[model samples]
Target chain A: MDLEDLYRILRTGHVQAQGIVDTVPDPMLVLDSALTVQSANRAFFRTFAVDRYDTIGQHLYDLGNGQWDIPELRRLLGEVIPKSSAVIDYKVEHDFPHIGKKIMLLTARTVFNPDNVSHLMLLSIVDITDRSRKEAEFEAVFGELRHRLKNVLGLVRALANQTKAEGVSGEEYRTAFLGRLQAVADANDLALSDHGDDSLDALVARATKPFQTAPETIIVEPSPPLTLASKEIMSLSLLLHELATNAVKYGALSAPAGTVRIRWEVEQGDHPLLRLSWRESGGPPVRKPASTGYGTQLIQFAIAYNLGGNVEQNYRTEGFEAEIVVPLERAARPD
Target chain B: MQKTILIVEDEFIIAMDLKVILERLGWRVLGPVPKVANALRLLEDELPTLALLDVNLGDQLVTPVAEALRSRGVPFAVASAYDKPELIGGAVLAGVPNAGKPTSEWSLLEVLAKLSPP
Candidate 1:
């Protein structure tokens, strides 16, 4: 080949190689045997926020005011790589002065000449800061799910044992226990599902769906959209279940013309509050119970104890009414 | 002295069930409080003969309440579904008798037996 043709071919090949290196998504550096920066890719420059003027020919350890002078990096390049010739996925966790913190996986390989003389090391950095963070978040979510499952089973057991079986038939006891168990399971399903719908409306609809005999039997008034935390979902579901069960049996859903209205709104303030009202009408005339039952206590406990909220129940002669007030922040607490 | 027991469980039904069981066992139940703050306040007013702690209370851990019980020299056991003691965390709760939840009357009796030595 003519010298002019050879020069053009070599120039084209150099440009192609540079283009390939620049296209790499991960930060990369070509370091000499003495660990001086021989070259860097576009990603490297962009990642470290440095320019070729300050980076090229500079010692790797001295780059960016010695930010690259990590003890682990020094060990890998100075000692480990010489013996191994290449190190793959060596972890280096460091807090950079400019960039807060980074967890990096470095894959480095020695570039050998035709005579097998290794002069340059190709170091590629895969920033795992975001990936590792997501992994950790997954672990936390998994742990929380396991915890919730255990607690649910525990609560179920407690329900089975605590369901008042005294002076009641075996069949009656079974029905009562099963009803509470169903409430717990339904609540847990709503809490743990990844449907991206944790709205209070969703919880109410799910919890009260089984008790509805007809479309207009129970009316849910159009309420502002409000989301609830898993904990709040569990507590509110149980409360709603208890209230609906009572209504179905005697208060609102028993008679043909019976109806129940459910509505809620957020009260804006220094500490926001969620006020939900359940008013029952058009059923058998209501009378205050002579003694409070387990269901009554459970309804109270679900709000007052579980959510640190207050519940006001009025057994009006016409129908039953309940006002539930929960602190917005408390209701939205992360599980 | 009344055989009073403090119950530290967040779940309303579970706490109520524990109270019923403890009452039936002839132990006067103290506050079956759901929060750490409530339990601590109850402890300030009175120290029960024993305490039963649940590992997680909503968003808070029961470690502070467990520590409070320990420093008061009141013996306690964990009533939780978590089989692993390490996951429960806290030096005070480790190796402490655990009555695994879904706790039967027998399991509770076992924990209660260990909690108090007549």
Candidate 2:
């Protein structure tokens, strides 16, 4: 072919190559043997927020005020690329200006002409920052789940060891221990359910469901929309379970005419407080025990220790009543 | 000596049970405080012969309490369900005695033996 015809064909081929590289989704750059940028695709400019004027003909290390001058990247290009025809999936983590910290996967391929002389290197960058961040978050959540499971098992063991066996038969002891365990499991299921809905009403309903002989036996008054953290939900579940268990054996739920009314409201003060009341009526006469039992201490500790709340119980001949007042910030999950 | 010991555990049942066990084991028990603030407050006025600390206390870690006890020269051991060091991350807890949870009586005695001198 004549020189003019050959020149036109080479120019057309170069433009077609440029078009194909620009279409690639990942940012790409063509570098000379000296590692200076000869060309960069549209994605390279868009992803790094740089223009062709500053990017073209600039040393790869000098681009964007030396943000790309990463030690790992340097080693990949300087040492690894020289020995191999292509370096694939060279992971580089760096803090880039205006882009924040980024985890990137780079692929560098040596380009050779017909004479088999390598004159250029093709570098493509895939930003895996978001993917890595999501992975880290997933790992944190999994660790938390594992930690919580261990704690639950530990708590169950503690419960078994502490369960009173003085006068109660084996069956009675088993029933008591299993009832408490059921309460804990129910609260956990509600807390960790896919929807993650831990509303006060839902917790009360779940904790009291097993004790409810009929739906009407237990009455829950309409309360404000309040969601609690997982710990708070667990504590509240135990508190409710103890109250219902007592009522079932000795209080309101034991009598057909008996009923328990549960209500809660937020009291606004210097610091907001959640006031929850459990009142029972229509059962046998109620009297305070001479000595506190496991149920009593569990109820007290579940409120005072776990929730940083206050519990006031009054054993009146008419019925048994308890009012719990917890700091609103601890009771309601902060938005 | 009175052989007094401090218990810094958050879980109510565990704390109460530990208190009973320690008492039965013939050691005088101080507050079974659940929060870091409570533990720090108790440390202000009283120093026990030894302490048992739970790694996670509701929302707070036991790092501050560990630091306080360390600075006070009071020996303590960690009680955690998590066995991994990274999971129970804290520079203060490195090489500290760990009494893993669901702790048996023998394990408790072993941890106590490590913290106290004969």
Candidate 3:
């Protein structure tokens, strides 16, 4: 078709030339250099809940219930006027009775018609609230994974140092060393696992998995469930493992007739307290080890250094006694 | 008189190394011992010119030993890989020189110099 024929058909068959922009699905607005609302599409009118016909020839800031920032938009318009294209996340809300929320990502460009004169600034806004919300959620999840992975790595380092001096060159020593190493790994794995509800008993049960077998006597006193912090959980797990190993080797658990008693109780009035005790009796007479070993060091390190808790071990003539004292609410501030 | 020096070290190999080094330095190494109790018992008998102590004797923190050395007026030096200055007790940091574990002959002599009767 010829140019004249195409122009006549578009003008006569379609609605008026000025009314075509009003029917678009995407919310769009046209502005002039004076920051005036030259025209607005029907979608724009529906989005801001304003009459587009009445909004035309009004100031851009006057539309949208005067929520569109006048000075701030002047700055953005300056940029788009020079660059001919700019996009940004924009927030526009009405000052009069809060008409409607216009939180959108908008792109604007300066347009010049065949007249060769810059007459309009065309702006298209897109709702991207869902995308930004998802991005935030993903970031938080990623951060949590990184932190947990680092905690696991730190546990591995502690295990490596704990087992390094055992002199495990031969097969027998190698087997014992590997078993202890796996125990540490297992504790770390449990720490990473989820506890649907906060329960201290369940956590301690998982931590004592390695030493809960026969030939070894382990007892847990009945107590109400308590909440514990992740750091406290990890540190306490390794500390208990070290103690249980020592009990198996030198303390009461080492002997057939010997027994290990684990007891804990929480006290609350003003400041809460979590007190635990490990007593071993009916074993051979206990004597202080001439040399402290890794097991003992690990228990001390975890209690004193990592968890900031108190520990006292007495090698009595009858048996070994260990007590640990800590606050009940481990996740308090400034701790 | 062979002046004695108590070695408060946890690892047997490292204790033996200290004994060898102290003896080679011409000082009598008494009880390259691992525990604090043994060192305390021996301290009642003779006054050592000095002591080479490992800050961490496995589970036994050497704070008590540092205090004992201070009470006896015997000079001592601390040696540990993981010693933090902030966590160190007052006696541990007061006038006592610190040398890391697995020390060289030169640094051992440096520690010995602090024990000299000045």
Instruction: Return the top candidate by TM-score.
Output: 2
> lDDT (CA) for every model shown?
0.87, 0.87, 0.67
Runs with alpha carbons beyond 4 Å of true place in candidate 2: A1-20, A36-39, A52-75, A93-101, A114-118, A165-170, A190-197, A221-230, A287-290, A330-335, B82-89
- Compose the digit string of candidate 2's lDDT tens values, residues A1-335: 99999999999999999999999999999998989999999999998889999999999999989978989988999999999999998888888779778888999999887686658999999988999999999999998888787788888888888888889999999999999899888888888877756888788888888877887899998887788877778888889999999999989899998999999987776787888999999999998888988898888988898678989999989999999988867447433
The residue pairs found clashing in candidate 2 are: none
| DockQ scores of the candidates | 0.74, 0.75, 0.04
Instruction: Evaluate residue B24 in candidate 3 and report its C-alpha lDDT on the 0 to 100 scale.
Output: 81
Tell me which of candidates 2 and 3 scores higher on lDDT.
Answer: 2
TM-score of chain A of each: 0.72, 0.79, 0.68
Weakest 10 consecutive residues of candidate 1 chain B by summed lDDT: B81-90
lDDT of 1 by residue, A199-235 (tens): 8878888888887788998899998888788778878
TM-score-better candidate, 1 vs 2: 2
Minimum summed lDDT over a 10-residue window in model 2 chain B is located at B81-90
TM-score of 3: 0.55
